[model samples]
Target: MEPDKLPLVQCSLALLAERLTPRDRVSIVGYAGNAGLVLEPTYDKEKVVAALARLEADGSTAGGQGIELAYRFAERNRMEGGINRIFLATDGDFNVGVTDIRALIGMVERERDTGITLTTLGFGSGNYNDAMMEQIADHANGNHAYIDNPREAQKVLEEELSSTLFTSPRT
Candidate 1:
């Protein structure tokens, strides 16, 4: 991943945080080789921002593990009738742990049925797995988007916040 995209991701996150409702619970997970919680699920926007602020770009991406940890955190603090989703923003594919595409998709499909969704935001250009991102989102009952600028980020994270975060009920 290019070193510069971190700032873009952070900028996009700032927009996302600004648009979140006070009742919205958010968890920030940054994964590379090893997955760990950057912030636990919380309703405080400032706390989310602070957690985001602490993120620095490094290591190979262990995206599957990252999503797993994200889901665990979201599941733990899930609200009865509110959005419980994981928004994964990345510049590339899962190159380290649990890197198999089929396995990852299967895992996401199973997790989606558990009631939490996964949205994927692909950033930068080369080495980015657009297909995997979209497929993962589809199976995870969420959305996938490629953001090239602040306007696009605003479109996904702010203008269309509800669609991006809210999972629809089955008929």
Candidate 2:
């Protein structure tokens, strides 16, 4: 991963924080070799942004583990009638744990059935698995966005935050 992409992600998340309300809970889970919770569920946007800024992409990407951990946090802090979504920001190159596409899709489908949708934020360009990212979002009743620059980030994380994060029930 290019070192600069991390800053873009950080800035994007900061922009997202500005849109969140006190009732919303935010948790960050990042994975390389293994997934770890960077921030616990909190309404404190500052803490969320700080955690994002501290993130330094390294090691092999355990994309599946990262999604699983994120779901756990989201489920734990889930609101009864509000949105419970996972924004998976990745290059979509799952070289490490749970690398199989079908298995990953199955996992996402199960989560979606339980009302936890996934939105894939594709970061970087080369070697980025656009197909996988789009498929994951499609199967999970979510959306996919490629964020390669600050303007695109603003468009996705700020301009379209409501529609991106809050979707109507699919009948």
Candidate 3:
């Protein structure tokens, strides 16, 4: 993650927290060299927002582990007919482990049958792997977006919250 793009990530997460209702269950995950469960699946907006605030753009990216952890959280607490999704905000760096694009895509693709969508919010420009993010999301039956500013974050997470959160974006 780019240090300069940190605010945009905060704004995006804040927007998401603001838009989530009591019915929605959210799990927050952060990854650098590995993955950490920032929050369990919960309806408490404060917990979710606080977890997002704890994320800092400092360290090597372990995107594969992060996605895997998010999937586990989603799968464990998955609702029968509810929208179970993993919302990844990153600079698209996968340096620490399982960096192979094919392997990462396959990891996510295999989880499609579980019905946990994987939406990626791309941040920053340098070293950003847009194609990989797009392909991962596409294969996981979800959407991909590049959020360059707070406004774009709002447009992606706030304005389109309903559609993006519950249903796949229309191609």
Candidate 4:
């Protein structure tokens, strides 16, 4: 990933952070060669911002591990009536670990019953697989957005934050 895009990601995160309240919780999970929790679920926006700042986009995408770890965190910290989502910001490449699309869909489908939705943010060019991102979101009963620049990031992560985060109860 280009170093310049880091600022755009940080900017988007800041915008999202601005909208957060004490009732909101954030967890940051990053994957490169492997997946790890950057920040545990917490109400502190500053902590979330700090975690995002420390991120560097390098190495192959280990999306499967990342998704599994993210789901684990979401399940553990689930809010009874509040939003439970995993915002997967990626270039849509899963080069390492469970790269098969069918496998990915199955994994996401299994988590659907947990009431944890996925929102895929497509970043980067050339390697950005919009189809894969859309499929992942669809399987998880969520949404997908293609964001190549700061403006698009703002539109999805800031201007439409509420719509992306809030969902009507599944009846």
Candidate 5:
């Protein structure tokens, strides 16, 4: 959650954005405290950063709300032009809210039908929640990665843009 680490995440998102054919929608579900804020698909960097910072300061940091928000956002996006994905960037801490891992995974699995993949980016180390991150991404038909540094983030954004952009068909 350092200032320096943000650019890496943002850069990754930006890289992913470029590959989007102007028709693709990228929604962000960011959680900080007990609240989950859904950001509409947009390529505006400053607005995205401000939204993320506000959520970071709000403080509940619940992953379940974040997931819920993403699912709902995807549903809404689907009505428009179908959803590309819901990207969750966090340290993987799911406290102060729904803490049941199995239940959360179940919810994500159900949402996968909406055609929105879930990609999780784990940041920081001391309080990271690897199990939860892996479960959500896996169940949602997406991949999870740990971003320990800015460089790694850029590499992921620049390199894995395709895999991250394409959603798996519901099985």
Candidate 6:
């Protein structure tokens, strides 16, 4: 049997879209094998939730595609003069395909130099890969946290909204 689609991840993404600035660019990175999965365009909460419902656990290669999509978005937005981040919402279990933790971390690290940060919101429990999620966030110069409930998602989004949106701290 396959795992269920995480509602918390969907809610968090929805909340994020609500808080994004007009200058901010939003992109989603979800599993490729999930046929009905579609990342809604920025600010489209209903579409995002609809897309999340169709998501399914595929393979580790899906994670790689997520990373690639994020990097490509960052590259394109390099000249936009605003915050750039890849908000990855996953269970963190990289299996059924190419599962090189190091390679994933390296890719995130390389992109960080270009001012692209990675924030991971982990979902589920049993199959969660805490180390990979945390390491990717750290190497990408960003942050990671698990959201098992809706309230936690709100806290993370409301409290860290500034940290997540603003690229630099005001001195």
Q: Pick out the ten consecutive residues of candidate 4 with the lowest summed lDDT.
A: 162-171
TM-score of each: 0.91, 0.92, 0.91, 0.91, 0.79, 0.79
Q: Cα deviation of 101 in candidate 2 (Å)?
A: 0.7
Q: Between candidates 1 and 3, which one is better according to lDDT?
A: 3
Model 5 lDDT per residue over 79-114, tens place: 445545777877547886788889888988888776
2 versus 5: better lDDT goes to? 2
Q: Candidate 5, clashing residue pairs?
A: 32-61, 33-59, 33-60, 33-61, 34-60
RMSD of 2: 1.7
Model 6 gets an lDDT of: 0.67
Q: List the residue pairs that clash in candidate 2.
A: none
Q: Count the backbone clashes (under 3 Å) in each candidate.
A: 0, 0, 0, 0, 5, 0
lDDT by residue (1-61, candidate 2, tens digit) is 4643667778877888877788888899989689999888887878888888888777479
Candidate 2 at residue 148, lDDT? 89
- lDDT of all the models against the reference? 0.81, 0.83, 0.82, 0.83, 0.69, 0.67
Worst 10 residues of 6 by lDDT: 32-41
Which 10 residues in a row give candidate 2 its minimum summed lDDT? 162-171
Candidate 4 lDDT over 1-171, as tens digits, reads 473355566667777777779998999999978999999888788888888889877758999999999999999999999889998988648899989999999999899889999998877677777899899998897888877777888888877766667644333
Candidate 6's displacement at residue 71, Å, is 1.1
Off by over 4 Å in 6: 1-5, 32-37, 44-50, 58-61, 164-171
lDDT, residue 161, model 5: 56
Error of 3 at 138 (Å): 0.6
Instruction: Give the per-residue lDDT of model 3 (tens digit) for 1-171.
Output: 454466678768877888677888888888876889878878887887788778776668989999999999999989898888888888757888888989998998889888888998898878888998998889888888999888788788877766667654433
* CA lDDT for candidate 3: 0.82
CA shift at 52, candidate 5, in angstroms? 4.1
Question: Tens digits of per-residue lDDT for model 1 on 1-171?
Answer: 354367678889888888667777778888966888888767677887888778876658989899888888888888887667788999777788898889998888778777888889998877789999998988888888898788888888877866556666432
Q: Which regions of candidate 1 are displaced past 4 Å? A: 1-4, 164-171
Estimate candidate 5's RMSD in Å: 3.0
